[model samples]
Target: MLRETWAEIDPGCIADNLRAIRGMLPAGVKLMAVVKANGYGHGDLEAAEAARQAGADYLGVAFLEEALRLRAGGVELPILILTPIRPDQVELALARDLTLTVTGADWFRELRKRHASFAGRKLRVHVKADTGLGRIGFRTMAEWDALVPWLASPDIDVDGFYTHFATAGQVDTAYLERQARRFAKLMERSKASGIAIRHYHCAGSAAALRFPGLALDMVRIGAAMYGFHPARPAPPVELKPALSLHSTLMQVKRVRRGEYIGYDNAYRPDADEWIGTVPLGYADGWSQRMQGAAALVRGQRAQVVGKISMDQLMLRLPGPFTPGDRVTLIGRQGGERISFAELAAHIDGPAQAITTALTERVAKMYANAKEVRCPWNNAYFQQLRRVSDGSRAD
Candidate 1:
């Protein structure tokens, strides 16, 4: 709380990005905004509200805890837990009326064994069909086919069928196409079996923009909605970045020649250099490997030097600056600008990981919005009730 560092979130940008992504979808195809991982560390309730206001058909979260948080925030839209809920969490998912992801029959059988938690309340399910991602979901046609009979049970309501593409945004989509073919074949057979799944979604940001044909009934849009291209060779659609990270210089010091800086003497000044200490480090999600990443100081790019410490990092300031001078860590400043994508490239990681890995110490501020819409903590849900009785007090 003492640090003058915080992430500013632009709700308007989020709305605009979703609109742009929506425009690219084929007619009749809906958009399910993925607000998982605290909306990629941009603030979940804020992003979810913006996406809902922008006409998102569904909101996606990673686990039952996030779904419950959204439900408590009065998010009434169809919220689906993208990850398969733990066996112990199924009851809470059903209790919150949040859709659950069913990977295979064995997971479903485990749920059935604990049916007493259902308490006569029907749980909506989404069959996660794994075409090629190979992490989770129905791997083979036989696995998917075997679950069809159990899906007909009154215990669980199968409402949607979808898959995650391994490489939807890359220039080469050979594997993505193969996965799409597998998905189509499965869907065609499911249709022949008379299994009426409501929503069929594949394609995240990249797949949806590159292959609209992959859009059946809905597309789970995530990174694109936040203005980050899911793949390189940018698509034609317009996207406005919604988040910007900022920090301030805590101390400015002059380093003489031959002076070693940081752990392991990672940086040695060949000449006298003005080094500014920024009160952010790997613990703040900047990552120890992020040393040498650039930040904007005095409207100019300042190269990070030395190894990043747990609570601090050194920036080679363009000139000696005051302690309170604002530093743009991942945003625009004067004529110079930096972005999460650039930082990720410096570290050789996905841009999303940079944002999502940001720790809670960093504050999140909202812009282009009237008031903050924060989700209630567990304190608000101390008095949990059954779904049959109207779920949470929300």
Candidate 2:
């Protein structure tokens, strides 16, 4: 961590959040920890390990590369690629025992054309039904019917069927109910087909916590696992945020009244005031839109007073602050706290956007490495003998 600005991630908080969510779910229902986008920029491997420690049933990633990375890190929990993978990449996925998300029949046809048959293991897959999100997945019964035969192949296993809701986090329940009804109809169709789907899930973090009945077979917990509740009024479970950002004042100076600061004269001091520079800017995920947002300097709010530059931004300090003083960008300092929700409200986006936008240039420091360990004991792994065989399966 050469840079003074870094994100501090608490894996124990993530594990605790997962445990709380699990307690809310039904006994038979599973929890799919969504660790995509580098665990929403909290570090993919670390988040996955935290989920495993909390007894997560499955892991979800958005791409094949992400699943491969988790496998390389010795994550044995069943992994489902939330997005569809290329037909040519099927073998690579199969070799790693990765479950894929199938949207339509054409993907299977192309895969079959590439390889006459899968050689060793049954290709595990989850059928994606686009109830309302409209991002991907089969929308009509006809599309599902077309994709069923391909999924029924002996070499393939229909491990799960799932959908995503567009308005799960919104106050309005009308659209969410409509989408749930549509998904229910699709599930009936699937039942009639007798494809033997193992898991039927439609609820993400918000929907699962808001409506426990919607937790059909599994809930994909992403934002909630990171202590983000997208819904209003909050859910019953207690979730603590796992990540916080901090930096130090790189430079401090006094500016005269009416003197412009930063590029294009974005700001001018009303009087002789102290200005502090932080070594984080738009390039580190602090965009220009955050110009007027506040950062905590010595437990006091300091308004960002100038156009955020590529690598640094100036703040109107509450008073004179020395260089190397600690600045809280998204965390607690004394009695003042700058939360991700507060920052997201400024940007008018989901809390995760602020986290995922953090570029690799901003270093990440894990706070609790010892507490979040593998839940499985040595005897458990020894009995499975997977460790000796280098097989990632439980």
Candidate 3:
């Protein structure tokens, strides 16, 4: 029987991309693999495990739920929650041993009081100073300075200090340079106040490429490490595309003159012609606006026709066609290639449509085709091993 249509992710491609990213940094420069947004919609656990095996020093997620998912997947590497946790999540945060990012003195004080039992453990926390991003962070140097001394106490362990660049990825080099200068001054002021922190990082994917100085003690590599190059004068290094989408032709038929096709009579044949329908459409993350867009069929471009339905789309081929023929949606087809960025541009502008519209309807299978090892895969395996033999290997 044919399997349900799904997206096949290449863990090896992710591993290769991580290797390429690590090659660019200095020997001691730390690398925190940013796996937010479910590893950019590739499934976080699969991506996180591959990333750790490929030498990622740390894992960064946007919220507590994502971090918990990683830990549940047997990921023991330090996972940092990049977004601010509400006062309510402190107990959950403490229970999971997850690190929290603090932007204000009041927030830190409350976290310490909640974890009073683990006073000696020193709840791991990071400080966010607003250098110039004007986002969620300590807005002034005075705010950070006042908060630093409290951290010096035994209640907290300030593991890192960082900030975000407002326009690094979308602007020119000069804009990034100015942000770097402001960041440097902020670090200088923090040092002058005698506040010591372990890891200092601010450079994201774009800033890391443009300004190496921004990679102070660590760099949180996001989309770039996954083989995507954000906006820069030029990419700091070459990268690979880690994701590919595929489908198969379901049926092919000939239509009479002026015969309409699909819903709403959106497409009608000028004369007798052959049309092929593939099992993909808006419900599967293929936009309806791409009705006239193109796809790769037998190593050539074919125009889409009619309104895309929930589970199918029609394409007008040059001549006769057959079912089970390969269809390439976002991969190489001989000399022709269609990229996600290209698809996004065709449907809508970058901000609203492209990346954001790719829904989770596409199924994801691993390229290696290994059996997935989710919690349901086994019962009482690892903890039992740890208890009987005193070894923890799963």
Candidate 4:
């Protein structure tokens, strides 16, 4: 059997998180699910379907290639490419019918030259205003304001105006308010120039929860859909975690006292102990520092007792552990569940310890999609759904 080290995505959780976000937004304010960073390291396509089923009006990704991938997958959602696009990719963007964040005329001109057919097509566009974030956007209010005429041009469809918040989820509320005020000013300037940008989004997952009513036309949600909170507290809503990391014990051996484990002599058996080696480690997204950390062994805590090698880790059980036992690295063990935030905090950072370090070698399995036999195949999702629905017995 293939090693059990993989990220498990629960599609049902995606639907639930979107429902929570939609309930918080004002009625008619749109919801755009941001599926960037491969859906924050949880397979993007699976998360995208979950978000869509949960009532997302639009989908956002960070790059043109990502948007293209979604389209190639037969996903027909209206996707907004949040990154500023180069002229070369504009044709692909047009061919794929993607909404791109426009920064200046040179880039737009390049698009116009290649996709002359765009003159007839309604190219939905969002202007990226650099309202103090100083990232990819129009640098000045005047520069942004001047785009109104082009935005209104019959050739292009100016659908939205948005700004990113540098402090929305990480800093003081007072600072966030200031950034919001700047965004408001930018909107007013756009209005004065007669550019009726229909959608105005300025909130990410962090801002959406922290600044509740600030959902202008729509809110962009990324991490929240995967069941992670945005640094600040959102309105009270039942949030379900959508991802779980798991593995099975590959071998169980009795270690003599003073025996070193794995590489570099990182961990030694405290006493004569039974150690279960699992096929998981830094190569599979389990953190190297998790040595001396804990994994859930059949709902009880088992301490990781060795250096996390590239493809495996050792866990010391208080008693004898069998080779076939299951281990939970990021899930509930009985009544106790390990949160990623908690896992990250345990190793001196956010539970980003594993998710952030997830390598491409690891496979992602979806419990809600059609199952395929391969490690990345999601065919078993139907079986999982049936079990969840009580249609099939365990």
Q: What lDDT would each prediction earn against the true structure? A: 0.80, 0.87, 0.73, 0.76
Poorly placed runs, candidate 1 (over 4 Å): 116-120, 369-394
Clashing pairs in 4: 344-349, 344-350, 344-351, 370-378, 370-379, 371-378, 371-379, 371-380, 372-379
Better of 2 and 4 by TM-score: 2
In model 2, residue pairs whose N, Cα or C atoms come closer than 3 Å (at least 3 residues apart or on different chains), thus clashing, are none
lDDT of 3 by residue, 213-315 (tens): 6678898887765566643355767766676666667788999889999999999988998898888888777778888888877777888899999889999
What shift in Å separates residue 342 of candidate 4 from its native position after superposition? 0.8
- lDDT, ranked from best to worst: 2, 1, 4, 3
Which of 2 and 3 is ahead in TM-score? 2
Q: What is the C-alpha RMSD of each candidate to the true structure, in Å?
A: 8.9, 9.1, 8.5, 4.0
TM-scores of the models, in the order given: 0.91, 0.92, 0.84, 0.88
Question: Residues 147-252, candidate 1, lDDT per residue (tens digit)?
Answer: 8887877666778999899987678878888998999998887777667789988888888888888888999988888888733667778787788877778888
- Using lDDT as the yardstick, the better of models 1 and 2 is 2
User: Backbone clash tally for model 2?
Assistant: 0
Q: Please report how far candidate 3 places residue 262 from its true position, in Å.
A: 4.2
User: On residues 58-87, what C-alpha lDDT tens digit does candidate 2 reach at each position?
Assistant: 999999999999999999999999999999
Best by TM-score: 2
Count clashes in each candidate, considering only residues at least 3 apart in sequence or on different chains: 0, 0, 2, 9
